[model samples]
Target: MAKLRTTFVCSNCGYSSPKWSGQCPGCREWNTMNEEVEEKTKVSAVSSVKSKTVFSSVSSVTEISTGDELRYNTGIGELDRVLGGGLVKGSVVLLSGDPGIGKSTLLMQACGTFSRDKTVLYVSGEESAKQLKLRAERLNVNSDKLFVMTETDVESICEYIKVNKPEVVMIDSIQTMNNAEIQSSPGSVTQVRECTNLLLRTGKSLDIPVIIVGHVNKDGAIAGPKVMEHIVDAVLYFEGERNYAYRILRAVKNRYGSTNEIGVFEMGDGGLSEVENPSQALLSERNVNVSGNCISCVMEGSRPILAEVQSLVCTSGYGNSRRMSTGFDFNRLSLILAVLEKRFGYRFSGMDTYLNIVGGLKLDEPAADLPVALALVSGFTDKPVPDDVVAIGEIGLSGEVRSVSRISARISEAARLGFTKCIVPRSCLKQIKTKADIEVIGVRNLHETIANVF
Candidate 1:
């Protein structure tokens, strides 16, 4: 043995210190330092010289080969859409979600598809081979080219990969993996960082794509050092309530494709099925002519989706009024209410206000502001917005309806969905040249919109 040493490391940020402290200096998180063992070995001069000799000359960006042939379809259209067409060769992808959020189910389905024409290896550190088989049987995944192995040691997993030469490899989770060279326990910051680097090297060296599953913390962030995300080529998050059947896949970072795209999937008894027409499915259960309800068309990536915005206004029982928003920003709701009171003279201070976005979808774009304001006003007056209308605009502090991007696509989608009327900004009306039969009404401010819409 060369020497046994110990040091304190911050589990949140991977910062090392000679002694433990109450707070991590790097991440400013309290009580996250843990003692980890280390064995120090000095490299000889000859070994150091040989390591320096292994460096390769850098190549110009123009000299690098690039084409569509490098992409591999994972057999799921929704997944392919999120992945910017398909998985890239020699790329590393990290998939993260809440527990039991169908991360494994989605990947298993993809593996079944990839195994049809290429070899795939599924490594599980948390579950036994028999347990994975049970899931595969439940998912009805029967592929001759898919291989499964239960292993926790990263080095041994790499050895198996080297011998088998799998076309693609999937680690069930990076947190459960451990490196013998690192004395920290599995899931520690050190082990996660080192193991991911090793897997990244293996993928690049073998020209194979590797997919790694990750767990999310209570804050809904990936449970690892930030470097783990920086190392991967793409970072995808699975979002949606576990109780709901709908799940949304979003890419936060992508080296091979655009990050704004999102994929929608519906969880079924058999597994996950892609939602081909998300707009139609989202509006399937709308209540016609209901007070406090208004439809809005917002763009998700390049696709336009129509969703219902609902609001409720009632007298406050307590001394202080309460404001609550679900699937909509609470601060933005307050701003809208202030604008309504200042510009339209609507009294919202003495009442409790509630806002919700239907279909379990979050509305983050500014284009939703107009519909939200309309819904608030409709609820306060106990009047319902027109069933045949859809609103698309951004409301500013001056109560002015601002033009939103891609107005043509929004109106076209509304028309396709059988809407006969569209409430949009006056500036956007000038740009619309569509022959769609829908009547597009242009409003300059919230006052005009309230008079015309109501």
Candidate 2:
């Protein structure tokens, strides 16, 4: 019999220690260390003979074959774009998001497409088979090749996979899975880690792709140890506000594809539908010729998306003016405000400023800086920029507009969306080899931009 031992593990980083402490030494996060039980197996003493072992042959990189078809289409164009063409074989993808964020719905919707030709195993630990069937019916996903199982035991699930090898395996979530060998409760650090490792081994050995759903913590990060993310071939995050119908699927890590790609989807009664033209959808309800509203173009992988930047500026009633930003970085906002005050003579210290990116889409690229600044200036002056104008450039500390990458693509997308004018950095004017129908106006600095827009 194995002896049961207890150890403290960090939920954030999966670091184990013999003693409990207020803070985790590995991750330096406080209150994340939790005690977990582990069993230690004893070695036999009658081991005089060596055990036989099988070794895998190593092949040269040039000798390896590359003609095999290794990707499976999930039947979703937007998803395929984010997955770098399609789902790679033997790849373990971790999909995570907030509850009710359509994580399960997205996978269930894909099962309909996957089960068209290949067999799929949909394992659910959170919902019963009947409940899954009800949801599938609502989603209009009816497929004979799709099989559902309400199971939580990791060993049993892997054994079943071995006996009946399904082309695709979808785990509803990894947190609910438990290993009988691990004494810790399900969703615990040890149990989650062991279960994922077991599933990963099975998927790789059988050349089957495994898609595992994951839950997010309060901080909006994937729940369980951070090592879980490192173990998976791809880590995809479904991002959007619950109140909003728009959802953005982003890949933070992809071994076979670019991580910069994102997929847009709109939630409805029939489940999630792909937003083919995200720019048009995002700007569908945008009010024209409105003060504090500006359009910006950003590149998500090879696709360029146009998003609306909105700003609100008003007199501050308190001692200090408040600065709030949604879907954009706060420090970047502060820097832009400082540049406006120092170089452009915009008095924002005495006024409260708010910034938001419409459509629940976050603007992380520096190219959004130009439109954000423009929106802020428009809000402060109570002047509306032209309705058919889009801005694409990065703002420097000296208030100079800096050139951004993919200037041609950005302008082309804006032009396709019916924008008449594009405000770009003067330095990028030379990079625009393909002449777009929209009038391209290049500005050198904040002074020129304000002179042209207003």
Candidate 3:
């Protein structure tokens, strides 16, 4: 019998320390350190000699080989677009989202695509084989080459991967998988790190693409070490309200593709269907000729989308005024209010103001700035901005309209949505041309823009 070795590890950042501390210096998380004990096993002289030879033979540094472009197209347009054209062989992708956000459904379809042309393995620790089959049957997509396995042990999963040598392998969730070498639960810090490391090694060594689904924490981020995201090739985030049918797959980080790309998906009985023309869905809830509502053009990566910006302004009571916002940024709303007061001479400080973007999509693009500002002003003055008028441009502190990214795309989206007029930066005037259906209006400042519109 040998002595037991133990160490304290921080669950937040995977910080390891010899002794337990009240505050983790590594991650600054309070009281997150947990003690993990490992049993020591004595190795014979012959075993130590064999271990040195094995360790020396395992190469740590190797050249990264790029995957073929043809294999990157997975038949799913939105997914492929987000993945920077397609799946790269030997790449590890981590897709994380809140529970019940169709993480499983999306991966099922990805597996189904490869199983038709090549061998694919769909490994799940959360669901049974029968359950996965039921989902596949309901979706009317069941492939013979798509093998389903329910296991959480890392060693056995590695053995399965070695035996099958499939073209692609997907783990339903990396959170639930654990390595036998770690003395912790399936989703603990130790297990997650080790499981991810092993999978990454396997993917690189065997040249098989691995996509792992991850669970999100309460703060709406992946529930694991930050290293988990860095260790993988790409980090995909699945977002959208469960009540709403539309779901978005956004790539926050990618090694093989651009991070700005997003994949739009609509959930239905048949599973998730890709929205080819996503702009149409963003403006589907708008009502024509409505007061306090304006069509706003926003840039999604390089693409443009038209969304409805609604604002409600009313006199306040008691002592304080209220400011509330939905989908759009709250800080930007505050700046817009200041512009309305200083530039438009409208005293909105004493009023209750609420700004709303019709759909649940979150946007930070500067193109929505002018529309949001105008929507608030339109609500305050009780003036209905013309139904055909669309706003696009960024607003500055001096009430000057700033240039936005991809103005041409924004103007085109507004016109495609049947908006006759667009208020954009004067610099964009050169790029915008006269169209029969839509009229593009260029403005340089806030006063000139408001006076012309009013």
Candidate 4:
């Protein structure tokens, strides 16, 4: 034997220390450090062909590159878009979401894509094969190669993968899989990390794509050690309110492509349906031809979306006015209010101003500023803007209508949503010509926008 070493690792954030402390420095958890054994032994191989593989993108003995030419399709467009176009081979992806929010639905759909064309083994730790079958039947999914195995033992799952040589493997959940090497309970920090590590190695050695779904904590974050995310090649967050019908798949990390992209999906009876154009679904059918409602066009990544903004302003009976905003940035709302007080001198401090973006959509783009302020003005004066009109432009502190990104995309999306008129930055006017029927009003400054809207 060469040597034996022991160390304490924080179960919360994977902070390893020489010894245990009363509190962990990584996640500030109390008494979470657990000791583990490490045995240094000679390398033994049961099967060996070569020490290196081209698919791994390893340049030398120790260091490796991940940008190898490997991208496998998961067979879902929305999932593909959220995953930066496809899955990176030998990468571990963590899929997380709220319970009953279709995390399993999305993963099952992914397996169905490969099950018909390629071999995929779905190791389910929580649901049985029969249970999974029922769900698949309900989804009306047909797959010949998607094998489902109900087991929680990490060792057995590894053996199955080694014997079956699957192209793609999905663990329904990582929390339920526990390694015998670790004595902790399944779903504990130690077991989650070790099981993930084993799967990580299996993915690299077998050149197979492995995806692990995890339950989120109460904080709406990934459960288990934060290092679980660090060890993976990609981290995807399946988000959106369950009460609402829509689900938003967001990518936090990607080694193969850009992470800024997002996938939109809607929850339905059969399964999750990919929303091709989600902007239309987010707008209200009830016409907003009244005060406190304004339309704004914004873009997430390359996709353009139209969002409705509503605001309320009234006289403040107290010493200071109350400014409340939902589905929008608070700071942006404050800036708009300040401009109304400073530049326009509207004296809004003596008023209670409430702002909201309709359809429960959160607006972060500065281009929404124009419509947000307009909605406030509409609410204060109780004047309704044109129902068919929409606006897109960033508002400055000095009331200038700044140009926004992808103006053409925004205009196109708005037009697709049947908006009759578009108010855009004058700077973007030269790049795009308005449609024959729809009118495009170009404004250079906030003064011009206010003058045009009112």
Q: Which candidate is the best by lDDT?
A: 2
lDDT string, candidate 3, 312-427, tens digits: 99999847999899888999899889987987788998999998887678768877888888888789888888888888889998898998777777777777767778888988
Candidate 1 TM-score, C-alpha based: 0.92
Model 1 clashing residue pairs (backbone): none
Model 2: residue 229 alpha-carbon error in angstroms: 0.8
Q: Write the per-residue lDDT of candidate 2 for residues 71-179, one digit (tens) a residue.
A: 9999999899889889999999999888899999999999999999999999999999999999999998899999999999988999999999999999998989988
Per-prediction TM-score = 0.92, 0.94, 0.88, 0.83
Ranked by TM-score, the better of candidates 3 and 4 is 3
Ranking by lDDT: 2, 1, 3, 4
Instruction: Flag regions of model 2 displaced more than 4 Å.
Output: 25-30, 42-54, 219-225
Residue 424 lDDT (model 3): 88
The count of residue-pair clashes in candidate 1 stands at: 0
Which segments of candidate 4 are over 4 A away from where they belong? 1-69, 219-226, 314-322, 433-437
- Scored by lDDT, model 3 comes in at 0.81
Candidate 1, lDDT over the whole model: 0.87
Model 1 bad stretches (over 4 Å): 1-54, 66-68, 219-222, 225-227
Consecutive 10-residue window with the lowest summed lDDT within model 1: 218-227
How many backbone clashes can be found in candidate 3? 1
Identify the superior model by TM-score, candidate 1 or candidate 4: 1
